[model samples]
Target: MFDVIDFLQTVGQDAQWRHADTEALAVALTEAEIDPELRVAILAGDEQGLQALLGQDPFCCLINPAKPDEEQEECDGSCEEEEENDNDKDKENDKGRG
Candidate 1:
């Protein structure tokens, strides 16, 4: 798995392989012992095909702190639940002090 990933990184960074013709790229892939399915996907420049062959899709999440005047987007309720839990803990502490 690491070798395959390394080969892909090398191909991406190295201009020789990046700009190579299909036949040359095919030969390079064969020499690198990359899986035939992966080789086909790479040669065809099919990103979705590669993801299908690998059995996973890319996932990403970006988070930024809201500015004072900016409205925050609603999430899936977990954040709200966490804040409520924290408020409950603070109330419990107040009761204990009393």
Candidate 2:
């Protein structure tokens, strides 16, 4: 998973947001793909809010925003399982062809 704090640092360093104001930073974060709540907290300089928001898996879309502290880890597990199944199928096909 990508580091939320690192991503935020990169965003802050980007030319577009280099000298951006609070509103601009918020817009940039919104456009960057994740929810705008984190941006809102950052602009407001609310450390606790930022930490709380970051606690959720930011990259996961299935995350229920209502429960920001708990991550829906099932998605990751299911994805890995699906990938393994695909690999196994490929191996079986190779064996059949051989």
Which candidate should be chosen as best, given lDDT against the real structure?
Answer: 1
For residue 60, model 2's alpha carbon misses the true position, in angstroms, by: 29
- Tens-digit lDDT string for candidate 1 (1-98): 56668888988898777567999888988999999989989889899998888777889989887899988787887998999999999999999999
**Per-model TM values vs. the true structure:** 0.60, 0.41
Global fold similarity of model 2 (TM-score):
0.41
Cα RMSD, each candidate: 12.4, 15.3
Worst 10 residues of 1 by lDDT: 11-20
Give candidate 2 regions above 4 Å deviation: 1-3, 12-18, 56-98
